[model samples]
Target chain A: MDPQKTGFDYSTFNPSYFQHLEQRIKDLDALGIQADLILFHPYDSWGFARMGQAMDKHYIQYIVARLASYKNIWWSLANEYDLMAQLGQKPLSAWDFIGKTVHQEDPSGHLLSIHNFYDPPVHKGTTKNWFDYTKPWITHLSIQSDNVFFVPKWLDDFQKPIIFDECRYEGNIEFGWGDNSAKGMVDSFYRIVLRGGYATHGETYIDKPNTTRPIWWAHGGILRGESQKRITYLKQLLATNGFNYVNPMAVQGPHWELAVGESPDKQHVFAYIGDNQPEFEIFDFLPKDNIYSAQVIDTWNMTSTKLNERIDKNHYFHIPRKPYQAILLTKIN
Target chain B: MDPQKTGFDYSTFNPSYFQHLEQRIKDLDALGIQADLILFHPYDSWGFARMGQAMDKHYIQYIVARLASYKNIWWSLANEYDLMAQLGQKPLSAWDFIGKTVHQEDPSGHLLSIHNFYDPPVHKGTTKNWFDYTKPWITHLSIQSDNVFFVPKWLDDFQKPIIFDECRYEGNIEFGWGDNSAKGMVDSFYRIVLRGGYATHGETYIDKPNTTRPIWWAHGGILRGESQKRITYLKQLLATNGFNYVNPMAVQGPHWELAVGESPDKQHVFAYIGDNQPEFEIFDFLPKDNIYSAQVIDTWNMTSTKLNERIDKNHYFHIPRKPYQAILLTKIN
Candidate 1:
């Protein structure tokens, strides 16, 4: 796969690659998708993973220089840098060079994070002090575990945005990390959001034996999964409502998760309950003296129904019998 | 109200109380249910939770003296003992006294453990060095979290028997800890067993508003939940198949959990695939040289079907498309 040794010198600096990437970014931007541009990944066998320091630095500069103008582009240093280290393939100095080069060259200072692999010695990358949240170059925390319980710890540690980049894919593949039912994927999405974080979507449905090689998880082509439509609904809701003000609140139940968003003037209270029927009372979390018109939101169906009765801290309203439900309490003033 | 303050001088030493408890133990023993007799609990409002040290010591001795004769009696010093300390109701010395008194007085030396409640100052009880597994009084570790991922950590920490006595009850109660669905409860049961630990079962389905106050969780009554049947199936399978020798094995997938069990003669391999439709290759975990007959076990439905084909490391077999499937490979010598 080394074209340089064959006297062709096929490099990432080729003008055709950026032209294609630029077109892809524009197409994604039109669809309201942010391009998470992973500059270096360890999956390649073409000697691209173990590139020399000088070539790596030049490649990072060229990529960032071309893509930094787009507002929708995010700079991901590598797909699984820890895995690269575990293979005894790359050195920390090379990763530092690439990260620093990307951070310094990109004028937009777009969101930057590195994806991680699970279990050590592959997980040793994030344990280093240089990967600390104090580092200004890294914009957010990107993790690849189904353990959402670590969300709070990372939130407190980083004090930055948390992105669950890989929380298992919605597909019927053989591998554990990639095979999740549509319902399971949807539950993970709600969990990440309720924990005050962002989640990435991926699918790996094996179309046939040898035909499904370029899957959505690796190649990123057509999304032939059910979660996309539901995620779009959530995205639209977040965009329409005051989602920026929302914060994850400590909930008492083991199965239930809660998030509250209220304006400074306290006109509305948005509470999101996750993965359980809302049969319990949320009256204590509501304002004591205000009469509020409440609406129960069926998350899966993406429908909201208004109640005829007014609710206050003293009153209890019936929560619909469903797996996942939310209530929006708005001050009627 | 305390009868002692009311001039009646009622104590735990009442012969009538012992007679009733003895009868209850005999009944439980007949039914093969080991009674986890909690001598002290924080929920008691009848002055039982805040008994003085002398009275508590006497209570523990009298209770153990009568109950130790039964083969099925296990001493649990307190239910949520940490919660008692958190409420500023009981001191650590009192707990130490009760634990020590029970361990010394009980001649049967039945399994002894202590249950812990979560959150701080309630969680502070186990943080002390006295609660360390090295303490001879504590025979096992009792925990109450849905995080089965911590099972390995506790296993390593205690080096003793680990019993997940309360990993949330199966019910629709308002409290988060007591309201897991039957399916969720069953999954937790598998997780506990796969991790080489013991789990306890309890039911909390609300019968009515005020009329059904005697829940199976608190007062002993008729069991009213769906998980009992499934748990019984698992119990019988484990009992017949020598599941005690099995250990949790490291699995690569995010959704899949694997446990391997082999008979004394190495004639059988029981691989438990948890929480995923088993579609992958189990060839690597199979004994490469031996031909084995495989059966797919549907844990929820409690059914096992034998496949016509024999399996080895080279051959892949079809697994049914469903969550929570297990495969048993017995040596076809």
Candidate 2:
């Protein structure tokens, strides 16, 4: 990418760029971080994004040849592919060609996806559903959405794994996408997870003037945000007691936000209350003999407290006086 | 409401209830708060919501007879009418009757609306758009939505004045609908406003155990939250320079969230940037002869610093490193 910046000159292909990427991946592996590699992006000051189809094919092949062996690598065909089209640079067919190229050439079968963003004038009338999720080359849907409400529909529409790759970052940077608070970031993480999808974490902290370097979002560097720690806590919670195995159940009635993830036998129930709701009665839809133990989870504070000793029939729970609260119910054997 | 809690008993209606209501209206007038009176709500422990059609008509007529004279009153047919139906007490026909009765009986012709909520099982497959904005009895759409993204669509769908009556209260309450933070509340308020809709503010802070009383959202004692002052600031911003009069311009291309409000002559341009957005060149879209003076409005902190002396074409202004930041452009002759 560095050498080809002047133009898509094949003569400028230096092995050092791949060496640096390989080294970075190894470092990321050390920290147990999965690297979602973007092969082409319009964030280019370089001419790499405007390369001809042949050059694009050459670059895609080169990237796969160098980095396909890594277990943590994911192939994001392009970052904001829609933005590129909006800028009148690359068209969808180019992305299709590049994606097919990556899918065919990568023998290790690293997960393939393409990042998308809203075209400007984000008002409601101008907004369009731009992504083709059913593409055979796409392994999963990677999205950057302004709202989380539409995620469920996308989940149902595509019937594939959905990843909230960009739900705004946690930082005080000069961009809206990177200025979300740690609490907001974690809240989105839980919201997506509760709704039967996944979300990724990024940080973009701006330090004292001229001291800001190696932003965690763009430039690979040390993590300096609070969300990662809380996300670690969430990851721990998901892995424990086989909690990660459950999928969100079909909810009916007025409490539309009461997103519940239940195990097959209905033994474990994780209910996420997104915002503050008034007092309501929660019916135990579990088996007749099952006595459910419910605990209040303060998601932001990462604390779990026992709410009730046993709930048999309908139980009245005064939801916490806070946002991002959840009720974790594990049935007593 | 307290005395008639047993049922819509006409015998229980006393002169003292009207006297108390008149005094409350006077008190609300003193505080400059327009009263949104609920004719019926599902929160009643009393049988008011389950009244027969005849009793419902009687109650509606009584309410109109007593309170319709107040100029500040807005009739809310019921709080979460669909919720009442889901509770198996009141049906939609009952709500339709109540709404029509309120519409016909009230001589003052105060704004009439009905509140709605989401049904549970938060997935997109189950989410239903239940509000009939086109109803003849309805004055405007009164909505309680979890996501603010739908506001623009609602504005378009109904083509009537939209009020986000309950877009989640700002508090740490155990309910997701009432536990939003002051910052989140203000952000939503601005978001709704920029998108050509109105939002209301409420608070529900629960103090230490057993000491909590008079929730600002329910009981309405005193203003205990921070959003009111910020909302006042927003109201002031809207009032100043007639900024509230402009509708958001149609945005095209990559910057989907550039919510703009401009004067009729295209002289005064108000652009709000929510969250941290990556850099984009802000072009001077006004007339050629006019010299535009730009200032950065820090919506959260209430600061407006002079940004540019004059912006012509392709102006590059780095947005503030914060959420809810705005760039206010005024034409200086």
Best by DockQ: 1
Assess candidate 1 and give its TM-score to the true structure: 0.87
What digit string (tens of lDDT, one per residue) describes model 2 on residues B1-333?
243566445535777978999889878978888998887777877677776788778777887998888878898888888877877768876777778788899887899998886532352322254557688878898877655555555666788888888887876543446557777788788777776778888887766323447577668777877878888887787778676455654333334445656666666777777654434334544456767888888888888899845765554445544556777788888
Best by TM-score: 1
Q: What TM-score does chain A reach in every model? A: 0.84, 0.88
Tens digits of lDDT, candidate 2, A1-333 = 353456556634789878998998999888988999888787877767777788788878888988999998999988888888777668876877888899999998889999887432352222254567798888899988646545556677788888888887887643446667777788788777766788888887766323446577667567777888888887787777466545665344444446666665567777777554434435444456667888888777889999855765454545544567777778886
Q: What's the chain B TM-score of candidate 1? A: 0.84
lDDT of 1 by residue, A1-333 (tens): 342553434354678967998999999999988998887777776667666787777778778888899989998887777777767657655666677788899888898888766642122123342245457778898777665544544676789888888887887655666667676777677767755678888887765334537677667778887778778877676656656634554433332435444544566566666554335554555665888888877777889899677877765555654665667777886
Off by over 4 Å in 1: A1-12, A52-55, A91-98, A120-130, A150-153, A208-212, A252-278, A307-309, B1-12, B46-55, B91-98, B119-131, B207-212, B251-275
lDDT by residue for model 1 over B135-196, one digit each (tens)? 77888887765655545546666788788787778766555566676777888887777666
Candidate 1 RMSD computed on C-alpha atoms after optimal superposition onto the true structure: 4.2
Error of 1 at B291 (Å): 3.3
Superposition error at A169 for model 2 (Å): 3.7
